[model samples]
Target: TLSEIATMAGVTPSTVSRALNPAASHLLSKKTSERILALCDHVGYRPSLLARGTATGFTYKVAMILHDMEKDLNAHDWNRITCATSAFLQESGYSLVLLRTSEKGTSMDMQVSHFLMSGIADAYITSPSMLKNNTLEMLNSLKSPLFVICEHGVPFPVSDGVLRSDADAFKQVWSRIPKEMHGKICFLSTINDNTQRLLTNIKRAAWDLGIDANNAISTLSLARTSKVPAMEYAEAYHQTKKMIKSFNQFDFVWCISDFFALGVKDALTECGRCPGKDVFILGYGDLETFPGVSEKPVLSTISANTHEIARNMCSVIMKKLDGEHTDIVTVKSSFISRSTF
Candidate 1:
């Protein structure tokens, strides 16, 4: 069918092939590409992915391995990141294959290995949480393109992935808070590796600014408290309400997420405290709202900048496919000032 289309367009089969692939379509003149595409539309010819893969040795699909979709499917940050990644890949003539490493009916390693051996994807985008001890070894042995989305302390080669520089982000955001409000800082956190690392960085940033962590810094881990449950927003709301009296001790409240920040703001408002005037509030992942129809987010936060991450991921992946050398990319987060601050 492609050969017939090429014949009608007065071009070679190879030219037709390049024109059909959006990523490589620029190789042809606009006039030539338009003619080929119009001819295909006239004939109602749709290219088969299997046929194209067999011929080009590329499946034009990227496997995105995720962990525990059952719970994380509700996360606003991950949803944004995944949607952005898919949109970027789609523009580059690639499809995304979502694979869960947990809550599936098979072992995570086995499922990943099967896909790798089957040539089901041209490349893979994965994070550290999706990998295990054995899975990392298998993934590293892959000759095809593999891009990792991780923070610090991953075992992969530096050139193969991107890192989120949250520590640097903390430093940037900390300096922007009102100097007077820096006297009593309280970190509202959850028990996780990322939260631990972030708290360490936050404390270091304060210390660098001539604020003593021992005297000014205090932490309340939501995960360790009995009042906290599965839901992040609800846990934050109830916990802040239960400890509303204690909140008077803090001059600044740094929340782990926008949801928590909003919850804390609401609780403070209900308890007759001015959030911005009394206690400056800051949150992470500058999300405007929840995943579905929900309360609008108005808290000042450090934006994870999913759009930039997606652009960088797609760029590096394309470069790798074109046999170009790529090094570790560090994406920086920025602060978003809002009424809460």
Candidate 2:
């Protein structure tokens, strides 16, 4: 790491970023940089914003807006949003300013205006914040260039939606699963306006697959804790664990996320049912970065491509920002097929 950092810093494999990094901004003070950097070997330190900017002419700072900081501390859907945004922003030469209620002088939503107003960031992109939050509601009222990154659905004045690539696989999982596998299939998803968009896409895909999503029972699985429950592998497992144990007439289990799918897996295990084998289990948000139901013999899942989502969302925003759109451009989820069916 020191060697890598030194190479990046360019002084020597021994010169550390702390020595050269500007303390006023976000790193060590000049004196400290000189003290330790001179003595220490560059063991793989990363370039600080100020130093990198001087050379590249780019600070790469991105102002990422999210309502809850706790969500990142304890990952859930919010984590997915964070990862995707960071990956895309960095690839395009930007850093992130995680806007929360406290960071902004007054409110969370105001953080965007505050940062943009101050000219701290080159552009403002909307991070996945909950729809129910008061700050988020206020944000919705303002027409910010905020693009929806991994949003559950499109928000108002915020069209150009970006999300993971694996969105389309929901239907395939349902089709492979027998309608009779469970007495009634239960779909556990986050409760928000985004639900409609997700359901809309799923419904359309399901119809194409000859599956009627409207007929399916909807069981809500809001986040009780952002942390994925250990009882089952995913949130879907815990959300409907009781139902599964009661031998609830549900035939199949569907979840909006792999976190939930893991939950379903555990529930099935408890009920003596086989996931992907005897019973059908499905998950959205195919996380190649993180392991999910794909490894399970009976589980099927769709992986979301953050890269594609970001690219598409950015394209839509550039056009809209340029006054090129009369309405919003919707980005749907992609599909990843595993043996879970």
Top model number, TM-score = 1
Off by over 4 Å in 1: 29-31, 102-108, 131-135, 138-141, 153-158, 191-194, 208-211, 223-230, 289-297
lDDT of 1 by residue, 29-56 (tens): 9998888888888888868987878877
Model 2, range 177-269, lDDT digits (tens) per residue? 555542376666655424666667666767777666677545555545444333225445565665555435555666766766766677777
Error of 1 at 196 (Å): 1.2
Candidate 1 minimal-lDDT segment of 10 residues: 223-232
Q: lDDT values of the candidates?
A: 0.74, 0.54
The true-versus-predicted C-alpha distance at residue 155 of model 1, in Å, is: 5.7
CA lDDT, candidate 2, residue 110: 67
After TM-score superposition, the amount by which residue 298's alpha carbon in candidate 2 deviates from its true location, in angstroms, is 6.5
